[model samples]
Target: MPANFTIVTLGVADLDRSARFYRDLGWEQRGDQAEGITWFRTSGSWVGLYGYDALAEDAATEPVPADELPTYRGVTLALNLASEAAVDLAFARVQEVGGTIVKPAARTDWGGYSGYFADPDGHLWEIAHNPYWTVVDGRVDIGAT
Candidate 1:
């Protein structure tokens, strides 16, 4: 069997609020889905927001108590932009939508510009513009390993 990546589901403390955050970020939600789960179509895949407890139960895993979780979850989602200005604009928009700016957009050592922000759920998202990368149809290609 071949493995294929499809959806990235975020287990959010408040599904509606998380959905709203994404919506405010200009993401359009997909209709015709179940009311219990909200789905958004991305360039190549889908992003889903579901209730944390419901997601845990669906995955057959135990939900970690809030206090037991660390401030950094050690995972980050990235959005690669076309220009440095776009990166800055994106970071600002994130802040406008109530996301915490972890780092301001600036030139990077790798000859690119990037910044970080944390969504309402503290999921880190990196907005970057890599000179060596090629973006097409909203997907990024880092070029040959």
Candidate 2:
């Protein structure tokens, strides 16, 4: 099988709260799925939200206590934008929707603009715009000069 990722499941403490957070960010939820789970169809993939314990049980693993998780979980989701202005706008929107800003948007050493934020469940999301990259139909394409 091809190594294609189709879904991203976020184990949330409160499904309703997490769902609301995403909704407040202007994301529409897909309600046709089974109960006890929430889904959102993104440009290219799907994002899901489920109860932390339930998700752990579904995965046949123990859920780590929230406190036991490190400040930096070492994984981040990204939203690629077309320009620095768009990146700044997205960063502001994230803050407006209750996301905690980890880093305010600014010019990066790689000649791009980017910032980071954490959702209600502390999932890190980086909003960035790389001059050499293009996002088409939610897929990123790196164009070389």
Candidate 3:
């Protein structure tokens, strides 16, 4: 199989609400109507928002109840910025959109600055500035700095 990472779809409780949250972050959806799902284009991948239980059904897996979903889902999506100031700005934008600040932006022991936040459905997003990596045009390239 080719090593191409193309899409990241998030299963959300209320599709419209999730769409709005992302849209508030300045992301434009593919279509005007979400019907039951929506898609937003990103620098390296496409982000999809679909119904929580419906997504599980499509994957032939049992769906976790919304109330029972754990705070940390064992996975996190990251937005790597070009500078420390950019990371700070991202955290501020997240808060402006009502995202829960899981970890306030601060200097990390790894010699970078980072912080975490949770969306309405408890999906964790890390906003970070990794000095070891190069971020050009909003995409991270390893070992290129």
Clashing pairs in 1: none
> Which 10-residue span in candidate 3 carries the lowest summed lDDT?
28-37
* Index of the highest-lDDT prediction: 3
Q: Residue by residue across 1-145, what tens digits does model 3's lDDT show?
A: 9999998989999988898899999887896544787899989789999999999999999997999988888999999999999988888889999999999989999999999999989999999999999999888888633
TM-scores, each model vs. reference = 0.91, 0.92, 0.95
Local lDDT at 134 for model 3: 90
The lDDT of each candidate is: 0.86, 0.87, 0.90
Locate the minimum summed-lDDT window of 10 residues in model 1.
Answer: 65-74
Q: Which parts of model 2 are misplaced by more than 4 Å?
A: 32-34, 143-145
Off by over 4 Å in 1: 1-3, 32-34
Give RMSD to native, each candidate.
1.7, 1.9, 1.6
Which tens-of-lDDT digit does each residue in 1-145 have in candidate 2?
Answer: 9988899999888888889889888787998435899998888888999988999999999988976776579899999988888888888888898899999999999999988999888999999999988878767898765
Q: What order do candidates take by TM-score, descending?
A: 3, 2, 1
lDDT, residue 137, candidate 1: 80
